[model samples]
Target: MLDDATKAKWYRIVFDLKKQFGKKPDMNGLIFLIGVRELGQMREFAKHEKMDLMHIATCKLLSYEGYYKFEHIDEEGWPHYSLVQKPPFTDLMSQENRLRKLIVDYYEDNGLFEDMDQA
Candidate 1:
């Protein structure tokens, strides 16, 4: 479990990233920001969230918008995302991103994502 300080740090990071980038962030971006170094781990997280499609589509949209560049790093064809300029929050989108990440994490920890996957 994450301690209070760690959670606060995550909140601040998400807040900053959102301030720099306008669009809502997806799972990959959040994972990347939290210092996840492996694309497979991120893919697992996506699989857990049932957000694989949403995450992939969001990455494509962000790439087209010139916010970042994405590369495929998985043998199963999952894309590894790298940011170009990072995100700019400065608005409600930042909070939204934070909320999204939190929700995803909650679902993951509660096995909701895992249960859905097995169903």
Candidate 2:
């Protein structure tokens, strides 16, 4: 399980992403930022940490939004990334602002921020 400090950092990243771009993020984008790992590997990591995949995905998306860079090896021995200079929060917002809004709305509807507020 992630420590409280880490969780707080993750939440801050998520909130900042929303504030900066006014949007939520895609799962694939999040997975890529988390390390470009395969789905099965991600699942395993989540299981090991006793966290849900959705939660992990959310945290990773936020991390990416907060400009946490990831490095992965491509076939050409070069690096690949979910974000290059910075996380593509603005680009994602442009591509699917409405969808992003809907996602944040759904999270609010589901009380995703209740715990944060309590803290």
Best of the candidates, lDDT: 1
| Model 2 spans > 4 angstroms off | 31-119
Candidate 1 Cα misplacement greater than 4 A, ranges? 1-49, 93-119
Q: Candidates' TM-scores?
A: 0.34, 0.28
Q: For candidate 1, write residues 1-119 as lDDT tens digits.
A: 45575465455555555766875555566545433322234544554444554555455445544675876667855666777886566566564544455544544454644555464
lDDT of 2 by residue, 40-112 (tens): 3533444443334443444444443454344564563333335434434556545354334334443455464
Residue 40's C-alpha lDDT in candidate 1?
Answer: 33
lDDT of 2: 0.44
lDDT of 1: 0.53
RMSD of each: 13.3, 14.5
